[model samples]
Target chain A: MTCEDLDRRLSEGARAADLAAEPAVATHLARCPECARLMAWLLRGIGDVRVDSARASEIARTGLKPVRSLPPARTLIMSLAAIVAGVAGLHVVTMGADGWPLLSGSQAIVFAAFLAVTLALLAPAWLSSLRPGARQRVHPVAAVLLLAAGFPALAALLFPVRLAEGLAAEGVRCVAGGAMAAAMASGLLFLVTRRGYPLDWGRTGALLGAIGGLAAVAALQVSCPRHEAVHLALWHGLALILPVLAGFLAGRRAG
Target chain B: MASPEQDAVPPRTGAAGAREALDAELLRLMPRYQDADRAAADALVLTAGPVLARYFYSLTGDTRLVEDLVQECWLRIHRARQSYRRGEPVLPWLMAIARHTRVDQYRRWKRSSGRETGIDGLVRQPSSDPRPGIENSLQAREVVAVLHRLPDSQREVLTMMKTNDMSVEEVALATGVSQAAVKQKAFRAYQAIRKALGVSRREENER
Candidate 1:
């Protein structure tokens, strides 16, 4: 064969080697001197890799353990908390307009019953763990659905309709503050639970302090209720930011 | 410290370890399947386990992580086996999963830590240095250096050939290129290496 033809075949051999071709590409290879030399060189290049096959097998075998592959409970808790907080906030807003004064004596007792139901629904992480082998492997779909159902339920529970006349003068600030406080509490508990404890008292105290700051912001907004759309929008923006920051700080510290 | 005799003994111990691990894995896998499916999985793991590790080593750079990474990849493959077609290139499917796992590792590390860990760690192992007396290994290194000078397409083809030992037909299949096209790319791969290594025309012709 011509040099070009030989070079072409050598290239073919390289490609053939890559594909694990049948009949060894031997017939074509035997007649080709340049290809043979190239093959020798290539063979020399693919060196012996001293692999411990047994060790590899050991690792592969152990990989059958499906435990670690499961998603962390913390992620589930966070998801549920988000849903609960959003729904609870919505409920509180609606309640203020509807006039449910959650601060009153007998009304507080009724509100607490609703709150317990809401918490039962919203705290999916708790509900899921209650199921047999539930803590072991919670499917993503189930976790998501649990969050979806619980959030609105919690919101409905925390919706405080009746507020004091003074609090109304401050606008929906009390309702917003109450909703945010609940969110902060739930988020902090989730965070603490995720850290292998029921709840760390120190972390809770710290979170409470953070939530207090958020509540103060809510108090300030109520006293000077904004009239302009832009001002109300900013107030809403601050409302989301305050609890998120508190939860974030509380969660991070809990870990 | 253990004596040389004791150190040498672990390899034999390792074989027994393999068997024990196999039994344990079978216990886990068997409960998840019935009849032929269990038998098929058992045979597949016993037959393909070693080769897959070798493939993983070839695909990735860190020798230390190969064992864990390959094991994880296989677990994923086993879990997703219901989707696999029978009598297909099982190795290729497995390799694809391994590649995806490597990419995921890269992305996860990058996202979490904010830095690229380099492609070497992803595929070309660094646990063992290139063996002595392997002119091919030397050439392969030179080829890799030359490949970096080429475009990504050419480099990828070169990598598949050198690392995976895929024939031209296999390379073509993997890359969706024809056999002739694979040869053409292979020629360019060598040419780039030749040019970079400063080999003379006579020397190249002789080889």
Candidate 2:
């Protein structure tokens, strides 16, 4: 057997003696000193090197002091949701919720449905960032990309406006408006979650940025006058990308 | 890779029962510790000291730094106690913090590599067992030496599993990665060890 095969077998729990009993493995072991050493170690087993912890308990007790635990995950989750809602409410209040009224009843319903689903999806990510050792099945960047694309995709598919003169000219302003809203919401989240030590800072930052971006998109959908499909889709997509990019960079920097 | 504890065949009494008892005790003490109970905090440090030491020892294999690292970890745990929710398994939280401490120590060491004494670089820890026997034929240093060549994250995953007798799920929880990621790192680490050992052996031969 090759040296790699021997290692694989040993790692798989095959006894060294049993492997050595085979002629090919023995021959291979005869030439490969590394394999031979590995076989010898496996045959004899290893000794435990003593670790000194005599003063650890004493050191630990001396350092003990007062500490207040964080609130429940639900409370933190609500606080995050509140940040988004608060930002959206303020945007709608200040800018006016005029765009949604421009759409048909079914179109408005579809838009609201998309926003609701996006919020539901994002809540767990916020909760996971707060809790240490939280299991994230999907990588953060992938999740961010999918969620970021979702808003614009909904806009592209549902709302197709005719190309009028200066149709997409106002898109940049809308994107900026959404970005500001995102930045504000994400900033509030950072303040509230300052005490939280996210194991994956990048994930936390990306999700934080995405939450803010989505809030801006939702708020702008209602408040912004332009309901043109390309305008909404392009600006909404840019809005989503901007905050996620900021958060990602921030997360990477923090991490 | 098979855990070192599993490979060693050492006579560890009530390993599972001991683990369960420790788990229960730590869980019981965590909430109290968070409530500013000095007595509970002391109890926690004392209880988790050995386990944390073993974990750090396995990851870094520097007995000298293990104590310091453990203490630093406890300080972090105390500071981040606010993040630890009630009724959660406390070891994962403690272990998760311990990992960051180890990582931070590594980063600091890397940053100051020009000034490092290089003492911690030596993973060749002397065995406590002095008796002349089969155990003497294979040193723990050699096993750790083979492990030392792995990438940091892979090495941490493998050594923590093998030496600490931690399961994949537990390691995943401690490291804040998926269990699949843990398994993949372990499998890759195992495959890499053979190649690493071969290279190390060649270097020694040339010397």
C-alpha local distance difference test of each model? 0.45, 0.72
> Where does candidate 2 stray beyond 4 Å?
A1-68, A161-169, A251-255, B1-13, B64-68, B108-138, B188-207
Scored against the true structure, residue A212 in model 1 reaches a CA lDDT of 32
Clash count per candidate: 31, 3
On residues A1-255, what C-alpha lDDT tens digit does candidate 1 reach at each position? 343554565567533343224354555457764455444444443333334444434434443532222235466456555544554454445434333322345534653453344344434434332211122232323333333333334334433323334433343664365445546555554443333321123333333333332333233333333322333233333453455456546544543
Instruction: Summarize candidate 2's per-residue lDDT along A1-255 as a digit string, tens digits.
Output: 786677555444344556788998989989987778666644542343333334544554555665556677678878988899999999888878878678888878988887777777677667667767665545555557667777777787788765645655677777778888999999999887676777667778888898898899889988877777778777777888889889988987887
Residue A87 displacement in candidate 1 (angstroms): 32
lDDT of 2: 0.72
* Per-residue accuracy of model 1 over B75-122 as CA lDDT, tens digit each: 555554433333334444444455555655665667787766665434
Once model 1 is optimally superposed onto the true structure by TM-score, how far is the C-alpha of residue B118 displaced, in angstroms? 7.0
